[model samples]
Target: MKALTMARLLIRLFGVVALMTLNSVAARAEIAIAVAGPMTGQNIFRGEQIQQGAQLAVADLNAKGGVLGQRVQLLVGDDACDPEQAVAVARKLATDGVVFVAGHVCSHSSIPASKVYEEEGILMISPASTNPKLTDEGGANVFRVCGRDDQQGLVAGNYLADVWADKSIAILHDNSVYGKGLADETRKQLHKRGVKEAMYASYMPGKSDYAELVSGMRAVAIDVMYFGGYGADAGLILREANNQDFEVQLVGGDSLTTEEFWMVAGPAGEGTLMTFGADPRMNPEAAEVVDQFRAQNFEPGGYTLHTYAAVQAWTQAAEIAGSLDLMAVIKALRTHRFHTVLGEISFDQNGDVTAPGYVWYRWTKGEYVPAK
Candidate 1:
């Protein structure tokens, strides 16, 4: 009888061990994270940046043994910078079980997609969207690595008023949330500085011809133009103005920092000025990664490093929180300062990065550099 009892006890112990092993295997399966942006369309370059940055981050993290002992997997969503498509992408990612998302580059897309993410309990960290309403009206799960339009607008407006006060200035927007919001903020600051815009207009984006708009600017003899739009539209406007033989200087927001601007404007992009955070590729901490990017023949320009920093911040927060639980990670993000390629980054209550304010950059020789 004693021998039989001992045999049963051993069998029970073996069964318990087998159950625990299965659980451990299930836990180590995979952890999904997503990166979304305009992977197709006119803005595909920015999407490529987002993909490459996030891809590198995932590879590096997995090499070091991914978060919480599970291998990290990346899901790429192409919103194409469209608001409806962004919503669809967000839903798909949420359904795919991604705990975090770093994406939706356009402000219009980011704003709408944020609602879906919030409802699905997924954390979203936008690497490029800069409109203030993104944070102001966003839920706790939403965050951004880039500075707001208002902040950048203040810089642009002040710079214009201080340096081009004597020149006839015009403000133009693409009628999107990002473009209009930036233009309005710049206009506010310009008026506060006692500078009146000679023309304030909205132009439809994605059109090939802006000749009518160029004609209007020419008629007003506008010497300085502040465009609150993307590089594509801005480049077209510059090309059209130049084709009309109009000598107007163009200043814009961070969206103009891409090579697409030069590709579209050619010689017209020369001397174009814009505002963006100090380039992360120039950061000492980022030298190794930048070298890796260069070795791959990819220039980590525009929002590339920003997306990488977003992933870095998210992983650090998860490590600090000790779990991927949404609330725990959110608390960790709010309380801890993350050391990123962009330098030390901390978040405010509204989920905006507290480091690296906007600065001036100029397009010259087919690339943008710190403006002289």
Candidate 2:
């Protein structure tokens, strides 16, 4: 009787062991995290940066056993920075069963994509969308890892107005949502600071020749120019202004900090000032990860650090939620303070990062050096 009992006990123990092993294997199975951005067209570079950063975060998270003990797989969607394309990508990502999404780098793209994610109950965290209206909608699932356009523009406008009070400043925009929005905000702030004699112009995008635009500023004897546009337009405008010997100070937002801006503008890029979300190499907490990204041949850019931080926040929120359910993750993200490579990540009621800040930088000698 004793021998028979021992045999039965051993069989039960073996069965339990086998079941546990299978469950562990299942736990290690691959899971998906979608990254949506402008993977093609003019803004593709920014999208690629966002993708690389999110990939870096996934690689690092997997190395540390990943979220929920499962490996993360990235699903890349190309929104082309178009509103309609963004909605399409968001719907596809939601239908494909991706637990989380980080991208739609452009604000215009993010605005429409957000609705899809919201309706699908997918957690969408934007690393580069800075439009105030994005998070102002009070969508529980919507979160931005960067500062708003209003904050960035206000900072730039105030700085210029206070430091260069006597200079004649001109404001130009590409007439796009982001460009016009930022330009109008900056103009408001500049006006409040008693800065006048400012020329505000909206240029039709895709126009390679900005000779007349630069000449118009010259005609007004403008000394400082604040441009709210992308690198392509800014580069051309700068090159044209330089060619025509406009001889003035030029400043812009994060869009002008790209390498393409320097490549296109060449010597015209000198003295160009801009703003960036955060620099991973300069962030003490992210220095090691920055090295790892560089080792992986990924050059970090403006959205790179923010995207990586967004992934970290998502993973932390998932752990806090104790489940992969989208609503649970969104609730956790709202209530929790996630420690990320970009430092502590927390959001306010408006879905914006708490105390989010932008760094002022200048292009000096073909490099974006932090402004003193």
Candidate 3:
């Protein structure tokens, strides 16, 4: 009887150990990916856009049995569009064991955070970071879904030369990496076309009043202002100009992609022109996802589709590689063309998307459409 009792206890102990091991395996069967951006600050909407896109993409991937049969676990980080904070967020994601990240919306954030991603052996794809240096200075893994500032600026400068050449044009930047880089490129092309700006200057961002700057443009009788800055500041400047009864056409960069630009500028934003990619929201490949967003009462505008494409590309690359190993996935990304809502995309030797470039957008009545 004693021997039988001991045997029964041993059997129960073995069964418990097997159950624990199975649970452990189940816990390890998920892969961690991250979407990071300014989750808080004046530009918190950017982070929300990144998160929404990533969430829906992950959902779709899981419904398709996930990547390599492993459930994808997503992480979120907030950089507040600050370089230092972005670096910190990258480090945290690394510590969290994330294998992939779609993040760092601003060029200011993306450029710095990319170093951490490279060092940690994580792949990063930016949905909207457009400064050339993010690719020119980034590692093998850094990529963007947006066109470079150089390309965007050329189009903008050429348009200005063609249409607004005779007007008194003033150029202003916010003195950040993205703002200044875009301003410089536009100015370079403007100079190439022999059209000199009436004023080239930097305005401090995050200020409530741009009255002084508006007065400067007014003093110069500036008929047009080419602003290389984010939408919030551009709208504020327009409001200040409008308040002062100074009528000046504001041509801004792609940062004005959101409806927030209109909300900030109000009626003052009427007829404002900005540069952005051809709207991916209008693409045929995007129709299903677009309908999904609309069903949820979300427009999925601006960089939302771009972020979705980033995830889609990474997903396809991982599946092609059949392994989440960094080098293997990287090789797959370089070799394969990914069909996304942004259309078919493939990475170049520099990891830049081999894709078509920029176009002009004009704000008419509260909505921005591809300019005619």
- Residue ranges of candidate 3 with Cα displaced over 4 Å: 1-20
Give the Cα RMSD of candidate 1. Answer: 4.9
How does model 3 fare in lDDT? 0.90
Ten contiguous residues minimizing lDDT sum, candidate 2 = 275-284
Highest TM-score: give the candidate number: 3
Between candidates 1 and 3, the one scoring higher on TM-score is 3
Global local distance difference test of model 2: 0.84
- Evaluate residue 225 in candidate 2 and report its C-alpha lDDT on the 0 to 100 scale: 88
Q: In candidate 1, where is summed lDDT lowest over 10 consecutive residues?
A: 23-32
**Candidate 1: where is the Cα deviation over 4 Å?**
1-28
Q: Candidate 3: deviation at residue 109, Å?
A: 0.8
| Global fold similarity of model 2 (TM-score) | 0.90
After superposing candidate 2, which stretches have Cα over 4 Å from the reference? 1-29
List all candidate RMSDs to the true structure.
4.9, 6.5, 2.4
Q: Residues 27-145, candidate 1: write the lDDT tens digits.
A: 55889999999999988888998999999989989999998777899999999999999999999999899999998899999999999999999999999999999989999999999
Candidate 2 per-residue C-alpha lDDT over 282-365 given as tens digits, one digit per residue, 9 for 90 to 100 = 778888888888888776866788889999999999999888888888788778898887788798767889855777888988
